[model samples]
Target: MKRILITGANRGLGLELTRQYLERGDQVFAASRQPDAATELQELQAQYPDHLFPVTLDVTDEASINAAHAAVRAKTDGLEILINNAGIYPGASADEPTNQRLGQLTGQGAIHVMQTNALGPILVSQQFLDLLQNGVKARILSLSSGLGSLTWKSSGDPYHYSASKAALNMYMRSLAAEVGHYGIISVLVDPGWVRTGMGGSGATLPPSDSARGIIRIADQLHTEENGSFLTWQGQPVPW
Candidate 1:
C-alpha cells in the first residue's frame, strides 16, 4: 500500500481523502491544525488502528510544517503521495480594504491569501522532498481551484481566492517542470464546488464524490501529466 500524507485533515476534502485511502488499506497521515479537533478521523483511527496516524499542522506556519516532517521521518523512511489540501477563503470583506471597493481585494489580503493557498504548498513540498525522494515512486498534489483559472475568471465572486489559486497554478507548473526528472509527478487539481464550509450550502457535489474522483485521478497521474492543471473529474483545466 502507498504511504500518503495529507494536510488539513480535520474536515472537508482532507477528511474524506483520509477515509478513502485508509479504506483501501493505504497508510495515511491525517494532518490538521489541532489533532484533537479531528473527531471523525479519531473515530476512523480507532477502526483502522494500523492505517491512520493523526498529525498536527498549520500550513501558514513554517514551524508546524517542519515539525510534521520530523514526526513522519520518525515513523517511516518515505512517503508515496503528498497532498496539499489545506486552504482558506478570506472573502470580499477581507479584500475590500486594500482596494477601497467592495469586490476589490486589498494587498495585505491578497498576500496573506497567497501565502496560505499558494506558497504554503510550495514550502511544504520543499520540506518533504527528501522523504519523497527516498521512495521509489512519488507524487505531489496541490489542491488548486477552478477560481484560479485565468481563462475562466471573466467574472467571479471570490477575488482573493481566485487570484491566489491562479498564482498557485503558476507555482505548481514551474516546480513540476524542475522536478519531473526525479520520477515525481507534481499536479495541480481543482476539486470542484463541493458542499463544505468553503464551498457553501449551494455547492452541487459531496465530499465523498469529490474525494473519490480526486483519488482516482491522483492514482493515474504520470510524468506526462506532470505540470498540468486538472479537475477532480480527471479533466484538464486551463492554467
Candidate 2:
C-alpha cells in the first residue's frame, strides 16, 4: 500500500479523498489545521487505527510546514503520493460577496487567499521532495480549479481565488519540469464544482465520485503525464 499525505483532511473533498484512500488500504497522513478537533478524522482513526495518521498543520506558516514534514518523516522513510489538497476560497459561500468583486478587491484579502491556495502547496511539496524521491513511484498532485484555466475562465467573479489557483497550476507545472527526471510525477488535479462549502449547494458533482476519480488518476500517472492539468475524471484540462 502507498503512503499518502492529504492536506485539508478535516472536511469536504479532502476528507473524502482520505476516506477513499484508506478504504483502498493505503496509509494516509491526514493533515489539517486542528486535526485533533476534527471529529470525522477521529472517527476514521478509530475504524482504521493503523492506517489513519493525523497531522496538525497550518499551511500558511513555514514552521508548521516543517513540523508537518517531521511528523510524517518520523513514521516513514518515503511517501508515494503527496496530495496538496488544503486551500481556501474566501467569499464562495457569501450571499453578497464584497471581496471577490472587481471594485471591492483588497490586497490584504487577496494575499490571504493566495497564501493558502497557492503558496501553501508549494511549500509543502518543497519540504516533502526528499521523501518523495525515496518513494516507490512518487507523485505530487495539487488540487486546482477550473477557474484557474485562462482558456476556460468565463467569469469575472472571485478574482482572488481564480488568480491564486492559476498561480498554483503554473507552479506545479514548473515544479514538474524540474523534478520529472527524478521519476516523480507532478500534476494539478481539478476536482470540479462539488457540493462542498467552497462549491456551495448548487454544484452538481458528489465528493465521493470526485475523490475516487482523483485516486484513479494518481495511480495511473506516468512520467509523460507529469505536467498535465487534469480533471478528477482524468481528462486533460485546457491551459
Candidate 3:
C-alpha cells in the first residue's frame, strides 16, 4: 500500500481523494488547517481508524508546515506520495479584495494567493525530501489549474490566482529536473473544472471523477512522466 499525504484534505477534492485512497486500503495522512473542525475527515477516520491519520497543516504558514513535517517524520521513515492540493481563489471571496478586473489587484491579496498556492507546496516538498527519498518510487504530484497555462492566458482572468499556479508549474518542473535522477517523479496536474468551492457550483464534473482520474494517473507514473502537465484523464496539457 502507498503511504500518501494530501494537503487541504478536509473538504472538496482533497477530501474525495482521501476517501477513495482509504477505500482502496492505503495509508492516508489527511491534512487540514483545522483538523478538529474537519467533520468529514473526522468521520472518515472513524471508519478507517488504522489507515487514516489527520495532520494539522496550514500551508500558508511556514511554522505550520514545519510542524506537520516533524509530525509525519515521527510516524514513518518514508512517504510514497505527497499531493499538494491546498489552494484558494482570490476572486471567489469578497473578503479577499481581489477582483478579475484590470488595475484592481491588491498587494495583500496577491501575496496571500502566491503564498498559499505557490510557496506552500515548495516548502512542504523541501521538508519531506528525505522521507520521499527513502520510499520506493516516490512521487510529488501538485494540483495545478488549466487557467495557469500560458497557452490559455487571456484578458480579465484573476491575476493572482492564475499567476500563482503558473509559478507552481515552473517550480515543480525545476524540481523534476534536479530530482528525477534520484528516482522521485514530480508532475503538475489540472484536475479539471470539478464542482467544488473553488470550481463553483456550475462546473460539469464531480469531485469523485477528478479524484479517481488523478489516482489512476498517479499510479501509472514512471520517471519519464516527470515534469509533465497533464489533465486528470492523463492527457497532455499545454504548458
Poorest stretch of ten by lDDT in candidate 3: 92-101
**lDDT of every predicted structure (CA atoms):** 0.86, 0.93, 0.91
How many residue pairs clash in all the candidates, one count each? Answer: 1, 0, 0
The digit string of per-residue lDDT tens for model 1 on 37-153 reads: 778989999999998999888888999999999998988899999999999876423333334235675788778888899889898898999889887679988999888888887
Candidate 2, residue 160: Cα displacement in angstroms equals 0.3
Question: Per-prediction TM-score, please?
Answer: 0.93, 0.98, 0.97
**lDDT tens per residue, model 2, 84-175:** 99998877666645497888999999999999999999999999999999999999999999999999999998899999999999999999
Q: Put the candidates in lDDT order, highest first.
A: 2, 3, 1
Error of 3 at 172 (Å): 0.4
lDDT of 2 at 174: 91
User: Among these predicted structures, which one has the highest TM-score?
Assistant: 2
Compose the digit string of candidate 3's lDDT tens values, residues 113-220: 899999999889888899899988999999999989999887556888899999999999999997798899999999999899878888999999999999998899
Scored against the true structure, residue 151 in model 3 reaches a CA lDDT of 97
The residue-level lDDT of candidate 1 at 23 comes to 88
What's the candidate order when arranged by decreasing TM-score?
2, 3, 1
10 residues in a row with least lDDT, candidate 2: 89-98
lDDT of 2 at 48: 99
User: Which numbered prediction scores highest in lDDT against the true structure?
Assistant: 2
